[model samples]
Target: MKLQVTGSISELLTGISHLSEELNFTIGSDGYPISVVKRPGPIEVKNANGQGEICFEKKIHFYRALGLWLQNFEKSKEFHIVEHPQFETSGVMIDASRNAVLTTDGIQMLLRKMAVMGLNLAMLYTEDTYEVPEYPYFGYMRGRYSEIEIKICDDYAEELGIEMIPCIQTLAHLKEALKWNYSNEFRDTESILLAGEPKTYEFLRTIIKSATKPYRSNRIHIGMDEAHELGLGKYLELNGYHNRFEIMNQHLKQVIHITEDLDLKPMIWSDMYFRLASKVGNYYDKDATIPEEIIKMIPNVQMVYWDYYHTEESHYEKMLTMHKLLVDEPIFAGGLWTWNGIAPNYGKAFRTTEAALKANKKFGIKEVFATMWGDNGAETPIQTVLPGMQLYAEYTYHQEVGPEHLAERFEFCTGYHLEDFLLLNHFDETPGVMKDNLYESNPSKFLLWQDILIGLYDKNIEGFPIAQHYEKLIQPLHDAKGKNHDMNLLFHFYEELARVLSVKAELGINLKNAYDQADKDAVHACSEKLSSLRKDVEKLRLAHKKLWFSTNKPFGWEVLDIRYGGLLTRIHSAEERVQEWLDDPTVRIEELEAERLFYNGIYTFGEEGTLGRNLYHRIVSNSVFSD
Candidate 1:
C-alpha cells in the first residue's frame, strides 16, 4: 500500500495512517502522487491500490475525501466521492459546567476523533467553568478550566483545523455563579443578570474579558436564552416596571458593546428574543412573531436557535423559517441526547438530528452544531456519545451515508464498532415498549436506581423482558472491551446493575404474596433472593465507583455514592423488616401485605414519581417497621 500524497491531501493520508497503521505510505513523490485537482463542485477521489488523487475544490473537502477513501479501502471496495458540507460550521458542543468537567486528556481524544470525522468546529459550552479573574467564586468547587488549560485546548484544536469557540452565558443560565456572595449585586432573580445596572455591565465586562482570553476565535456565544422572568426580579425593585423585552434588549446591547470593545463578534440563543417578541413563553410556538421595532433593537449578533426536541423535519422547517425572519444567519443547535441519565439516547438523537439537519440544508442554512448537555449531574460519560458525534459529522458532509458505512468510519476513528457502542442506548429502552417519552422517562435508569423494597418502575416492566436484555448485552460488551479497560469497568457496572434489577423487580411481589398467605417456605425463598440482590447491589456500587473515577474526576462521584449508599441502607432495612415479620407472626407487615403495587408514571426532579428519588420515597412512604 505504498503511496505518495500531495501537500493538499497530506493531512488526509496522515489521518488514515492514524486510524490504520498497517498501510505503508509516503508523500511528495513521483510514484502515484496523490494530487488535489480543482473540481467545480463535490469531492471526487480516483484511487488505485490505495494510491490516488483527491479532487476537491476547498481544503475542507479533503477530510470528506479521506473518509470516503477509508470506507472503500476498509471494505475492499472501489473508491467513492463526497460533497461539500451542508452547513458551513459543523461541530459538537460539550457541557463542561454541569458537575462533570471533561479532563484535558478526554478532550484531546475527542479532538482526534473529530478530526477523522471531518468536523471543523468545537464549543465548550461553559456556564461558569472558565476562570473569571474578578469573580473568585464563579466556578468555585466546580472543576473549572484555567487560562492555561483553555489555551492548550485552543492550540490543540487549531492543529486539528477546528475552531474552538467560547460559549458562555451572558444574561441567564448563571445559576451556579449567582450562588456566591459577591454575585448578589449583579443577580436579577436567581438566574438572570440585573438589567439596567452599571455594576451588572461591569461584571459582564470581567466575564467577557476572562472567557475570551484563551480562545483563538473572535466569535463568542453570549447565551441569552430562557431568561423568562427578566426584569420581574431585583431589576424591577431598582427600576420601575418596564417591558421584559425592553429590559432584555437594553442588557443585550450593553453586552454587545462590551464584546465590540473587546474586538469580538457575539452570538446568542434566539429563544429570548422570540419569547419576548411573541409574548409567548413557549420556545417552539410556530406562529410566534417578532415586532419590527424589537427586531431593530437587536444588535448585530449571530442568533442561534437551539432546538433539541423536534423529531419531525416540518417542525424544524417552521422553526428555522421563523428564526430566519427574526435574525439573519441563524445557527441551529440540535441535541446529541447525552444528558438523559447514565447513558446516551442514540435512537432519539439520530432521529431528531437527521430531521433537523435535513431542514437546515433545505433552508440553505450555512452553520449548525450539536449539543451534548449534562443537565442533571452529568452522569453519562462523554465518550458514550461518540456515535452521535460521528453521525453529525457524516450528515454535515454527505447526507446519504448509511448505517453500515457510518459504522465502518466510526470503528476506524475510535477503535470501537458502532453497534458495540450503541449498547449504551439499550439501557434506557424497554423491550416491547416504544420510548416516545423524553430522556427523563428512561426505564433502565429508573430500574437501576429503583428501590429494592418498593420497586416503582418494576411493575412498569410488563412487556420489557429486561433480564433477558441485560443477559444478551453482557457477552458482546465483554468482547468489545479489549484494551479499553475503563469500558470493561463500565460494562461490569451495567452487568451488575442488570443482575440487581432482575431480582429486585420480582422480590417485592414475591415478598408481598408470601406475607399475605403466611407461607413460611415462600418467605424464606424471598429472603434468599433478597440476600442475593443485596450482594448484586454492592457489586454494582463498587463497579460504578471504579468506572466513575476511571473516566472522570472525583468531584462528582459523591452524588453517585449518596444515591447508591441510600439504596443499600434501604435494602438492609427491608431485610430486617422482613426477618422480624417472619420470626413473629404477630408482627404486622401491613405495607408488604397491602394490595398489588402499581407503576405510577411520574417524571419530575426531586419529586415522588421521579426515577431515582421515587424508589427512596416509596420505601420511606410505606414503611411497615421502624428504620
Candidate 2:
C-alpha cells in the first residue's frame, strides 16, 4: 500500500503517523504534496498528533483508512466510512432523452452506487420521461417516465444524501412528443426550433414548470447544447433569422426566464461559452465550433463545462481556456471518459481524472460529474460502469499524489490486472478475432493495440446495426424483398460501415507513411494502435453476429414474440455465412459494406418505385410533424 500527503509541513507528518500502524507503510516526507511518497515497511508511528494534515492519492490507502474504522468495530456495529469535515458531492447527467431509456431498476441501481461514492447530486436528462401528469400526452412515445417512477427514484436519491436534478432537453430532440401532433402552441410555424414549434421558448417554459413542481433542487440543467440544426429554411423564412448565434441566445434567454420564474437556478451546458472563447491554439478554429453568444452570456447563468475525453491533452488544455474565459459563477463539470453501453474507457478516464484533479486545483472547478451516457438505449447494463466510477470517486475525492502513483492503488481497489481490468472493465471486450488481427499485423503492438481498440469500440455503437443488417441481408438474400427489408436497420448499417471503413483507411495511411520514418517509441505506439483497431473490428463482427442471430428470436422476448426469434433464425444459411467472416476483419469489413450497398440498392431500384408496406409506413409515420 502507498499513500502521498499534501498540505502544511506539520499536517503532512501528523497524517502519516495517524495511519502508520494501519497502512503498514513508511511515509517519506518531502516538503510539498508531490514530494511525499509512501513505501511498504513495518508499521511505525512517531509524532502523528501534530497540527498538520495529509491526503492520500492511492485509494487502497484511503480504503485502509476506512478499514481502520471498520477494524475497530465495537461488537456488531461500525461505520463504513469515517466522517470528514468536507461532504462529498457528485453531479451526474444521464441523457435518457435521446431514444435511450433507463429503466426504474437501472435508476435505483445507479443511485445505490452514487451513494457509495458519496455523490450527492444526480440528474436524469429526460425529454419524454417524467412528464407532468396534467399534460399526460406531452412527451408521448419519447417521454416514457411517469411522475411516480421519478418520485421513487427521487426519494431514494434523497435518502442517500444525493439530490436528483431532472434534466430536460426542452428545445431540440423533442421529436418524440412532436410526432404526436398534439400541440397548437406554435403549430403554424416551421418545426425548426423544437417540440414541433418554431416558438421553442414556450415549449421550454412548460417543461420547466412541470419538472420543477415536484423536484426541490434549485439547480436544473436545461440542456441547450447541440442545437446544430437551428434556423434552417422555415426559421429563416419566418423572419430572416440567418444569425444562429442571435437565435441561440434568444432561446437561452427565454429558458433562463422560465428558470427564474420557477424560482430555480439554471445550469446549462457551457459549450456555448467555450465556443466563444479564444481558439486557444491553432488546432481549434472559432468558426468550426459553438457560437460566441455562449461566452458573452454564460456569466449571467450557472454553467456546466462537459468534455468526456479529458485524458487527451488537447481536451484538458481547452478546458483550461474555458475556465479562464468564464471567471465568474460556480463553474463545475467533469471530463467524460465512458458513455454508451460499451466498457468504460479507463485510459482516457484515468488520464482525464488525473488532469481534472490538477485542473480543479488550477481552475477552481468546485464540482464534477463522471458521465455514463445511455446512447443506444439500455442495451448494456448501467452497472457495467460502476467500477470505473469508483476509480474516479477515489481520485476526485482523495488527492495526494501524481497520476502514476494512483495506478497501483487502482489495481488494489478493483482486484483486476491493471491493463486487463482497464480493457475489460472500461472498454469493449475485443472479440477473439480482433486480437488475432493485431497478432497478425504486428506482434509488438499486441498489448497496447488490444487495449486501445477496446476503448474505441466502447465509444462506437456501429456494431449493433452492422450485425443486424448483415443478418437481414444474409437471411433470405435470394428471396427477401420490400417490407422484409428493414430500412432503419440498413441505414444504420451503411452509416456504421462507412465510419469503420474510414477508420481502417486512416489506419492504413498512417501505417504506410509512419512505419518507415518512425522512431522506436513511435513505431511501438503505432503498432499498438493498429492492434487495438483490429480488436475493435473483431468485436464489431461479433456484435454483428449477436444482433443478426437474435433479431427474430431475442433471448428475453419469448413472452412478447414467440415466433420472431424462430423466424429470424430460420433464414437458411444466414448464420453460417456470417460465421465464416467471424475470424477475418478484412473479409468482415468488405462483406458488411457490400451487404449495406445491396440493401440500399434494393430500396432505391428506381427513382419513384412504389415503396414496400414497411418502408411506406416508416416514411409516412416519420414524415409528419408532431407536438
lDDT of 2 at 254: 73
Assess every candidate by TM-score: 0.88, 0.56
Residue range 36-120, candidate 1, lDDT tens digits: 6765677787667646667766444665565566556666545655566677788889888887777776677777678767787
Best by TM-score: 1
Model 2: how far residue 572 lies from native, Å = 4.1
lDDT of each: 0.74, 0.44
lDDT of 2 by residue, 1-627 (tens): 333444323423433353344334454553212222243421111112221221333222332333332232322232223223122345566656544456665576566545434455678877666676556676555536767777777766655456888787655555555555554454323333432244556666777777766676787877766555566545555656455556666767777777888888887775644343336422234333444544565435666666654344455555556455554634455534334222334444555556665665455556667676644223323434555566555555555445453444433333223333332221222322232121111111111121221121211222223223223332232222122232223223223333333344233223323333433454344455544444445544444334333321122222212222222232122233333333332333222222111112232222221111112112111224244
What candidate 2 gets wrong by more than 4 Å, as runs, is 1-68, 71-88, 98-100, 183-199, 273-299, 312-318, 330-332, 335-342, 400-627
RMSD in angstroms, candidate 2? 15.8
Q: Candidate 1, which segments miss by more than 4 Å at Cα?
A: 1-4, 9-41, 55-60, 77-80, 277-280, 435-440, 462-464, 482-490, 589-627
